[model samples]
Target: MELRLTLSLTAALLLPGLAIAADAHADTAPAASRQAELPAWEQLSAEQRELLISPLRDRWNAQPQERARMLEHAKRWKALPPEARERARKGVHRFEQMDPEQRRIARAIFAATRDMSPEQREQFRKDWARMSPAQRQEWLRKHPAPEGGRGR
Candidate 1:
């Protein structure tokens, strides 16, 4: 998938986009700049600071290419229209609220559909709509998310 689409899906499916973007490039910043920025970070309430810090820490710990990609993705996210950003934010929030099984179902659907043609996606939706709750659960049990996927 294209990086932008992948980021959109991952952000919508996995984490909130705007918050993570802020932390993406922190490590590449010069030391003096970081030092100069410390007080601003300190001024934030612990909750506010954590909103930014955790993502930065994750970025810092990522493989070099992954870090660079995350930074790039963050930049792209920043450039999105406000409505688009809001939509993604809401999507992340909804995803965050799902029970693990629901999230697994979501991830399964996402993985199954991400690469589909329009017609194929339509057909899958039709098939999905035909399944009873138990059947849906059975389908999901047969096709669990890849190891450690979907917030596991």
Candidate 2:
């Protein structure tokens, strides 16, 4: 709902006290400087460089604003404590392994709950916690992931 779909996972990596401060002006001088010092394609690790390759080899330019946000997010990720980093890595890995349909369902669920009031959210949590494992499984089976997968 807040349009943080791209970096929500990255933001979740932060502990409450250490969450990166939101910047109203993303094109600030420090961000510009960081972008200027971004590593060249050849300088990145194989996995990092691979992210730049388009499946169709389409020509594109990375927007400076987007690049700055990425670098900022990376800096925050690197600064996380080892335990936090490991937890974040496991979460990201799990998300990556989800099928398209599962991902679509997850996104929908996220959107649906994103703005819930604290009391409503707490009640939902309480209801979930009250469910038995078998009940949870049955509920999931009844509400399967979207069949059509993601939409354009």
Candidate 3:
């Protein structure tokens, strides 16, 4: 009976360790496969990849409702003329280049703009358009850039 109890206790301790080892191996195995499958972009360091793709990818992978909204917006974007797409891509590049604080303010502005009614959005656009370049620069000056570099 003592031998049996010792064996049982040993098995109990060893079994959990084995299971944990198996789980760790299993998890890493798939990640390795995924890394292999990833494109050149995925081969980049996480920071570089995030810098290049996070905004659109995050938008795409947001919660289901938000994802649907983003998809709808993308469909509309796709329908835009090539020149418009190029212009929009330039805008996105600018946004990506902004420091974190500026990006945060821009995100807030976008959220507020998106929440506005069509007429309100149009009014905001008109107001923004009326601002002088100096005024726009001053507005941006109020928001400080993030330290320690942009989100990698």
Best by TM-score: 1
lDDT of 2 by residue, 1-152 (tens): 21233124333422222222223223556867967866886787775445444411232244454455555656887887888777666545554666664465454444344466757755755665687878755755665543443211
Which model is ahead, 1 or 2, in terms of lDDT?
A: 1
Score residue 65 of candidate 2 by CA lDDT.
40
Residue 127, candidate 1: how far off, in angstroms? 2.1
Q: Give the Å shift of residue 4 in candidate 3.
A: 78
Instruction: For candidate 1, give the lDDT.
Output: 0.63
Each model's lDDT comes to: 0.63, 0.49, 0.47
Which is superior by lDDT, 2 or 3? 2
> Model 3 reaches what TM-score against the true structure?
0.36
* Candidate 3, poorest ten consecutive residues by summed lDDT: 11-20
The top-ranked prediction according to lDDT is 1
Model 2, position 29, has a per-residue lDDT of 69
Q: Name the lDDT value of residue 87 in candidate 1.
A: 72
| lDDT by residue (tens digit), candidate 3, 34-128 | 66755686466876555555556654566565566556555676687877655555555455456655554454345335446768866866666
Deviation in Å, model 2, residue 74 alpha carbon: 1.6
Ranking by lDDT: 1, 2, 3
lDDT of 3: 0.47
